[model samples]
Target: MRVLHLAPYPPARDGIGAYARVLAAALADRGHETAVVAARPHPSSPPEVLGALGDPGLPEKIARFRPDLVHVQFAVPAFGLRVPAVLRLLRELDAPVVATLHEITRDTALLRAPGRLLYRRLASRCAALIVHTRDARAAAGSAELIPHFCAPPPPSTTTSDALRARFSLGSAPVVLAFGFIHVDKGLDVLADALRHVDDAMLVVAGAVRARDPLFKPMELRDRRHEREVRAALTRHGLAHRVVFTGHVPEAEVAAWFATAAVAVLPYRKAAQSGVAHLALASRTPLVATAVGGLPDLFSASGSATEPREAGEPSRGLLAPPGDAAELAKAIRTVLDGGGHPLQGLAPGPEEVAARTEALYERVLAGAV
Candidate 1:
């Protein structure tokens, strides 16, 4: 099968980009010929509202690739106007299109009204939609939940001792918050939660691209968020407990996960998270917000718990969104082993690669 996998690819290392790159590689390994139509981020590429308008030569690039099936890894915010235009081109080509919706927010999320409208338009045109979690399915009109996969664990280059030494970290428990930095990811709340944790260090390993003028940075929202988070840490006198490693390479990330005692995805919203899935693949226990696709993703682990009988509380410590106090309590409980450990998160890259290959085959067969 010839497949053209589209989304934010390299040079823009966001989660959706990572997902597209990895998924395309996996599909290629499964015997399908895959070509990727990746767009560069603004300032780095061009500042056109639609990402591809900056790239005048993309259509010729797609025509040359001539894929049998086109899979679009669509994120409302990142693709900008390029997303809809890509869909329109695919429609003209009459290729079977599969759009994987990476997020779903009614309002006040990253994309705002225009983003949602664009996403809705793109989704409506696709032949099939792929969702990462059940929570995503609920948010998307009618999408299939094809569980997201992770990269294969890298060979152990450095032991825990070596990792600790490299980062100047002590023997204190390390809780990893890995992946791209964003306002909705609940980092500020996590920062506040750190005050309640004793002898535990939060290693935030991700890039801070949320509000940069180059790539749709939420100046007001993210700036205010960063300020409040710093203020909270200072108020609690816990400034020294956090290490912010802004966007390290992939090789370095594996070492952080291997050394950390656990991982966290305390998101304010839930569509689906590749971070949570990656943590599970890394064999690291996780404590995440009980919203969106997280509940379904971790439901297999017995880790997802509803604190209240329906409306009383969330199944997984269900804290109110943006509530620093509740988030702090949840992190403390998880570190202390009071929360669920999720012992069954050991899926390997081989398994993920196989499943992804099967999905590509299914899409190709149906489309052709």
Candidate 2:
């Protein structure tokens, strides 16, 4: 089926952007004609730039392509341009629409009250909705929960051993906290937790942008969180061990993943994480907090290497949110677990893409 993906995509560089980019690639691989319409959030651009252009000739583009469905990978606050306007246009075109909820918050996590109100107006109008995990599904209210698809980074063509060596890491045990650095990401908590692991070096990758929701707040606590992350690292003498490689390019990230012993998600608030999916696709062991849709990602059957069973604990270890000591303990478990990497927890990209295709077909059949 011809499918149009109306969601934020890179080089805009955000979680949902990355998700939409990769998902579009997978849909194309599944023999569906997929095209993406993304927003360009310039530093100086007005906040309502996307909304100003209503359909912005998007209907013509959709009609020209003749898509069977228009799938929106929603990110609530970030992908504002795509969701509400696209959903509104689909109504005019009388075409089926699918809204993928990348975030599901019962209470406000990031977006301000006004932003939340705007999001709700758009969310309630979709033909159907998709979320990444069961937790997200439960939060979706009337939307469908679809498993996210993850494809392996095209076979490692580069060697991160050189990169690792360059940092004097020289085979030091590495724990990666990948993706955008935001207040919700709990980087300070991670920095505090790592103070206990003397031999381990933390590789904090991903870029920081002003549009990042974390900095949107003017509260002293939020500002102080950013300051504390930098200050705490220095105060604790962790400046050398904690490396923030601000937003490494996509092409270069796979090598870092390959070099790491484990990847951590120290999110204070989350809906679902594409980083966790990427780590799983890379077949790396994971350590994450037990919030949002994270616990649904893995299962622990006492078999550390395999994915968790339906009712089992997660494949990865989980700790309390914002507790540095608990986060540190979870990290220790992953490191001491005799190298049992988390694998086979979820379907591969092909399987996930197939499932998505079936969902698209159902939506076209008026299942939504």
Candidate 3:
């Protein structure tokens, strides 16, 4: 089968783009021909990236590619949180589309009634809407649940001692918090939690989403929150406890996960997290908030816990979103547990790709 990935592919600096790159590579390895139509023009993108969104002649280019299916790595953040642009892509695409809704519960999380209507409109045009968790499938009303893809963890190149020395980290457990630097990610909550943990060091493995000359409202909000976090940390004399390694490369990202005693996702609001999947790939022990589809990951069913989120008490791996005290406790618990990595990584990348291919077959046959 031939497939075309429609997303912010690499050189574009989005996780879903990185996702598309990996999925396309896996599909190609599975003997399928694959290509990409990036979300924007990135001059340095690889050859398989044939065109970009908003190119007047992109439709012609996709027509020439003649893909059997088009997979859209749909996320509001990737579109700079613009609904109209997302709608335009859904309405205008001229091939069978299977959209991976990277975020679904955001509308519900914020109680934004209009966003729900927009989601419905987007779903109506697709052959199938794919979500990574059953919580998302439930919230989406109509969607297919696919396991998130995780490539095997790479071997750690540098020892923990070397990593600590390189980063000027003192003798303390490292708690990692990564992905886009944004307020909703609860960096403020994380900073406050650090006050309680007392001994661990935080390695913030990212920078703000992107640079904007005019400074859009969203950009301003993120920057303001980051400043507040920094100020609070300084006031508490915890400035030396945190290190911000802004926007690192893939190798460095691996290194951080390798050295981290625990990975914390203290999102105040979220749809799901790609970072969680990365931690799973790294087999890093995690402490995450109960929000969006995160609960589905802990549930053996990967299904709904519904009206209330599920918690992994057996593993002590979950905390209430935005609760600094609970987050601090969870981090301490992981550290006390000797940093034994979390177990289980079923349905790795190849399995996920095969499942995706099966979904494509269903869509092409009008069975989805």
Q: Which sections of candidate 2 miss by over 4 Å? A: 41-57, 80-91, 106-108, 112-119, 212-215, 218-224, 300-315, 338-343
TM-score for candidate 1, residues paired by index: 0.80
TM-score against truth, every candidate = 0.80, 0.84, 0.88
Tell me the deviation in Å of residue 118 in model 1: 1.7
Per-residue lDDT for 219-283 in model 1, tens only?
45665666676677778887678777777676666677778877878788767677776666665
lDDT of model number 1? 0.66
Ten-residue region with minimum lDDT total, candidate 1 = 307-316
Best by TM-score: 3
Q: Which one wins on lDDT?
A: 3
Q: Residue-wise lDDT of candidate 2 within 152-220, one digit each (tens)?
A: 555555677866866677678899999876678888899999987778999988755444344345334
lDDT for each candidate structure: 0.66, 0.70, 0.78
lDDT of 2 at 103: 72
For model 2 the TM-score comes to 0.84
Clash counts per candidate, in order, are 10, 9, 0
Give the C-alpha miss distance for residue 240 in model 3, angstroms: 1.0
The runs of at least 3 residues in candidate 3 whose Cα sits more than 4 Å from the true structure, single-residue gaps closed, are: 81-93, 107-111, 152-162, 211-215, 299-316, 338-343
